[model samples]
Target: MDDEYAKLIRRMNPPRVVIDNDASADATVIQVDSVNKPGILLEVVQVLTDMNLTVRKAYISSDGGWFMDVFNVVDQNGNKIRDKEVIDYIQTRLENGANYAPSLQETVDALPTEEHTSIELTGTDRPGLLSEVCAVLAALQCNVVNAEIWTHNTRAAAVVYVTDDSTGYAITDPNRLSTIRELLCNVLKRNNDVRMPKTTVSSPGVTNRGRRLHQIMLADRDYERVERSGMGRVDDKSSRPHVSMVNIERDYTVITMRSKDRPKLLFDIVCTLTDMGYVVFHGMVSSGRTEAHQEFYIRHIDGRPIRSDAERDRLIQCLEAAIERRASEGLELELCTEDRVGLLSDITRVFRENSLCIRRAEISTIGGKAK
Candidate 1:
């Protein structure tokens, strides 16, 4: 009997989540048992938010690659979520996992054309410090526009230009700005090995420009997979930075880059090239099973190909750094394709299968096309 019971338990999925309602208490209790991994806390919290569920309290513990977490949650209506279907849906998603992929058209429709916000900081620096800052910004739905970081005398100062991705404008709201400031100040203080922040900061307003992208993929679409060819690849797979260049016999220069996809990735690369005096005549962007491939055909603004080896080397270094920064920042991705039934679910499943995590999403339809 013991052997049979052990076998049965072993055959079950590793992650087992249970949801229960406390009617008198006016809240739902969620218990999760799962394998431990980095960022699991963030993932669970994000799921609750996506469901419009508010967390009243949470207790988390992890040891020996296993974790047990319990969350006291309430629905948007400030009552327990007791619907069986809704509870089952949440359980399925948390147990299996789901992703929200925002289409490209959605980004164009939502982001501002010119206005953007800025964050400035000065403090002692250490390794992995920028990554931490970017992580916080990503969590807060802020996207970087321009970042300049410098260090001197063991003190680091950074000025980051950003835009609320949802609004594409400078964060002018006082409460939101205060929250960002407090969060960043706390991060910097911690990095400097200082005391914790004591003040309770205000919460900010978030305007919804479009639909939330975290709806779980169900039905046939969830089973579909994105073709590997749809995403491009580098011919020289062993390339360290996964970026290569070729001069087209004084006609044009071809720069091929392969990296994990992120929001505004193409924008960043093209912006860098344009700033460097190159004019793109044509380009192609595609997703691979695990990476994104981008090809840009261009020449100098003066219609001349990059001729000098030194200039070519400099360009290579710049592109490499840009790719590295995006990867570390953990940004979003844009998907554009002809719409069909279950399209969103299919696309999001592709990203999930490839190990891409979606932090935020927006979906919109324009001109009879879904973005």
Candidate 2:
């Protein structure tokens, strides 16, 4: 009954967003007022990120079942937002926060009704692994539609969307899919012992492909440190995340985190916590040019603080893994060209032959152009 009442209240008082360009001389200021709810903060931030806006500064306050946030945001060039169309879109998206604006991810993930076959794979990180997988897919008449790959901590995870080369749609043949799985499994198993490679074909749009990558790496235990010696080893301690938790007033667990700031850092932390079934009741975030700091007063859904040291340690490990998995490393590279059936295969093969390792990559093709 109480939950229903909360929903009624939320509907009665929809979010209100006020965009004021004159509020700040350097950046546009956006203020949002709404009924407080779990994950509301994240939803607001996600909107700004989808529009590719950089948040220069923010003031967040949600208390007594009310949420009021003000953000100073700018365009990619760090200039104030004055374009009327973009301003209107931002206001519309923010006012209807529950229905989020579609990001590039939605396009990559394709349709939610199984327009493509989604593949999830994780295994030991090594050079030419991506090439090998691409080669095998090309051989089996699978067209790579869109894919996202991330490598860290001697582990790799990839979520790939593919369709039948002949039909340009999801592959439904059980026999052919079985063959594809068997061959890719063989390729992934090669030179992998730390953790056996997992390859599973799931329906498209079952989960957000990006967040699924985070979950995949976390499940593979990439947060736990290992020896750094091989070619893909990361030795940067400065980018490492610091996470600690303490009890406050014997009522809530106060989690404080500090690390080098990057885009989507807040979303990553909040997503991980929500996935672990914790709710952030109160929090603060401050992100500058180089570093980011966040503090959260959280509790389990059952309304209890952390029960034991083991739980605290495990939560810390998961949060740390979340930060490192997305760390920016390696040489920046770009490839923009026409999209084709065997293009990914050929490109990855050349990368392998040249001994170049791809630490992270975002693959997409639109309007006959692959990038």
Candidate 3:
């Protein structure tokens, strides 16, 4: 009854969305006003990220039963949004109350799926692991549909969408899935790994794939500092996000973060905090050419400020890991080739043979083409 009442209230007060190109000379300004609700902030951010726009700055305020956010966003090239169709699309999408959850799949670096099985894997990071994993899938007759992989702190995690090569549909045979999981787990395991490798198979959903990766790594505790630094080990402190927290009056924890700016950065930070059971009452975000600065006034879901140094340290570590998980470390590469069985396997094999390390990668299929 409470949930239905909230929905009714939201419907009664339609959101007011403004896409103003004149508000900021440097970037387009988007403002949304609506009845406050849980997860609405993330939904809005997800919409912009789905369109591939860079949110350079944002102001979030959801208090006193109302929600309002202002965003300064730019195109991929860091210019104001000038396309009329795009502007109209943004306004319509936000104002009409279309579901933003579906957009999350695209933001997570996967195209809308027709039918595919999501393969999740995590283990110690290694050079040839990807090649071995791909080879295992190809051997099992699973065709790569779309996927995203991230490696950090000497730990690797991947969400791969695969279909039956022969049927071009989700691999649903229980035996095949079990075999796929077993083989992939074997490929992920290392002799020196402290933790066991894991593999899970499921039909993909609207949940953001990138956030799913973050959750997987967090569960694997990738934030723990790797004492012995080597290849793919995130010992490079330079790339880690700088986080600071201070208790303010009225019992609020003010968390400030500064880091190199990237796409969907705000969303990543907010998503992590929320998942950690922290609620942001207010936030201010600003990003320059290369660096982003964010300040969030928050409290625990239990209505308390962060209590101890240990808790603070853990929070900082988790936030840093979330940021670094998606950091673009390797040379920017784009692969646009014909989609076929074993194509990904062959490509990964060449990279592994060349001793190339893949920090992060995304695979997609569109109109019979793969990228």
**What tens-digit string does per-residue lDDT give for candidate 3 at 22-137?**
98889999999999876777778877876788988889898668989999999988899898867877776677643433333333355436588889999998788888889999
TM-score of 2: 0.89
- Residue pairs clashing in model 3 are none
Among these predictions, the greatest lDDT belongs to: 3
Candidate 2 C-alpha lDDT tens digits along 1-371 = 99999999999999999999998988899999999988787778767766667776677677569998888888878899888878887888788873454434432223334667888899888899999999999998888878989987788899998888999889999888888888888888856385788998867764556677888888888877877567656577776789999998778899999888877677677778877888777777777789888888888867888999999999998999887777687687789998999999999899999999988888877677888
Off by over 4 Å in 1: 1-117, 121-240, 328-371
61-161 in candidate 1: lDDT tens per residue?
55345667777777767788878867877787677643432322232233322365646565444444555566677767775544344432233455455
Off by over 4 Å in 2: 98-113, 190-194
Instruction: Score residue 343 of candidate 2 by CA lDDT.
Output: 96
- Of the candidates numbered 1 and 3, which has the greater TM-score value? 3
How are the candidates ranked when ordered by TM-score, highest leading? 3, 2, 1
Rank ordering of all candidates by lDDT, starting from the highest = 3, 2, 1
- Give the winner by lDDT: 1 or 3: 3
**lDDT (Cα, 0-100) at 40 in candidate 3:** 75
Candidate 1: C-alpha lDDT: 0.54
Where's the lowest-lDDT run of ten residues in candidate 3? 99-108
